[model samples]
Target: MKVGITGASGYVGQFIVRHFLQRGYTVRVLLRNVQKTKIFCAPDGRFEWTCGDMSNDVVLSEFVDGVHAVVHGAYDHLPGRYRGGEGDNLTGFLESNLNRSLALMQLAHGAGVEKFVFISSRAVYASGHLRGNLQEHSAAQPDTFYGAYKAAVEAMVSAWAYQLHWHAVSLRLTGVYGVVNPLARSKWYDIARAVVRGEEYSQGRNATEVHGDDVARAVELLLHEADARGQAVNCSDRLVSNREIAEIIQSISGERGPLPPQAKAVSPAVMDCAYLQRKGFRFGGVGRLRQSLRELVEAVQKEQRSSQ
Candidate 1:
């Protein structure tokens, strides 16, 4: 099966591409610049990339020409943030993300793709909803433009599914974590480094997080799942706190710096994943996180030593 995936060079997209390749699928990636494909693909040496912006109908159509499925994870945002990623240009943000995304959906549907998997975000849920037990059926009241855009595309995915009469599942992902490569830093790289360097980290944030590999597994499962059609399923493994993160880092790096203060008792939106669980998808909990963090911490220490 040929799977055409967008955003193959991104931090999250790298894992999805690798997972599909490991599963023995013919993976063709969509890239804006054809030459940039060498940056990531050279390592695996097993990718067929379609070079051209997805906004260009000719290029995108060529990409979806023979693929059995399409996984869309591309996003244009300001560096280091997603919620307020628009920064100064709301119109540009909407035009680039929402408009182009809808176009991709229409083109994929027209090209007779069997399945469409949209990488949606948990940002679709507002902070109010986070206070409760969040489920796939939870109502979405997106607070940020980023969330609103993702929610909008998700609605379109379902609508397109009705038109296609086949599989389309929006994996509403939480804070995705893990290191795909040394070039790509884990989400907790800075925090772990600060704690390792014996810096006091008082401010700690907590959220539901899943390993990147697990997110790919969810995508892999839904593609083959006969029952995963026209539904938005929550794809999160467990709730992770900043204090827990400090402890994990300290345990590995042997940092004696004070572990981050206990996070206050706040209602964290723990995303319910009963659907994924029933589908026989197992998540890499803290154990997997620790292994990934070990590699990340070692890299951080190596960088710190080299700079000194």
Candidate 2:
């Protein structure tokens, strides 16, 4: 099987590519800067690299050619840039991204690909907090423009799936952590470092999180699982509290700090992954969270020592 992935050098995209490659699928990645992804430039010929952005028609055309399936992980929203911040031109950003996304969907459908897996976000559930629990059939009320756009794209893909008789899966991801993406903002890393430095720590909200590896695995399962087709499922592992996260970081890094108080007596609705579990997808959950934190801390320490 050949899998074509957009934004293949990104944090999540890289993980998806690695997962597919590990499963023995030939992977092709679209990248704007091939030189930055030397780690994936394997000589074994299992991975192919195409250099271009997602907006290029010629590039998008060649990307889906002869591929069995395509994973659309490419997105342009940067933190604090296009999320309706002050002086942010969110309208322009949305217009551009929506155009690109719709075009890609059409292109992939036209390419005779077997399946298309769209990496969506849990933010699509704008009133998810109001509901005691989030479910697959729950009404979507996206608060932020990011959430709105994701919801919009999901709807578009679903429509195409039915209208065009295409197999499509949208994985609504939660806060994805684990494995260091140097350019990405990882709250887990921030908390771990605070513990390592013995700094005062506090958290504003508690939320669910899933490891990058687990998310990749979910996408892989959706590839062959008939039950996953034409479905939009929440892909999350465990409900994580801020205080619990601090404790886990402290324990794993062996760093003592002024930890925050235990999370308030509140059982918020966790993103429901029961659907995924029933489909025979087992998640690593919080059992491996500490080990992942340890690896992240060790990597940080190694980089620090090398720099010094």
CA lDDT of each candidate? 0.84, 0.78
Can you give the lDDT of residue 77 in candidate 2?
66
In the range 104-184, model 1's lDDT, one tens digit per residue, is 877887888889899998888886545766788877788889999999988888876777686787989988888755533
- Candidate 1, residue 234: the lDDT equals 90
Backbone clashes, each candidate: 0, 0
Q: Worst lDDT window (10 residues) for model 2?
A: 78-87
Off-target runs (Cα >4 Å) in candidate 1 are 39-45, 181-184
lDDT of 2 by residue, 120-222 (tens): 9887887434646688788678888777888888898788778777888889998777774562255476776677678877864577788888988898888
Error of 1 at 160 (Å): 1.4
TM for candidate 2 is: 0.91
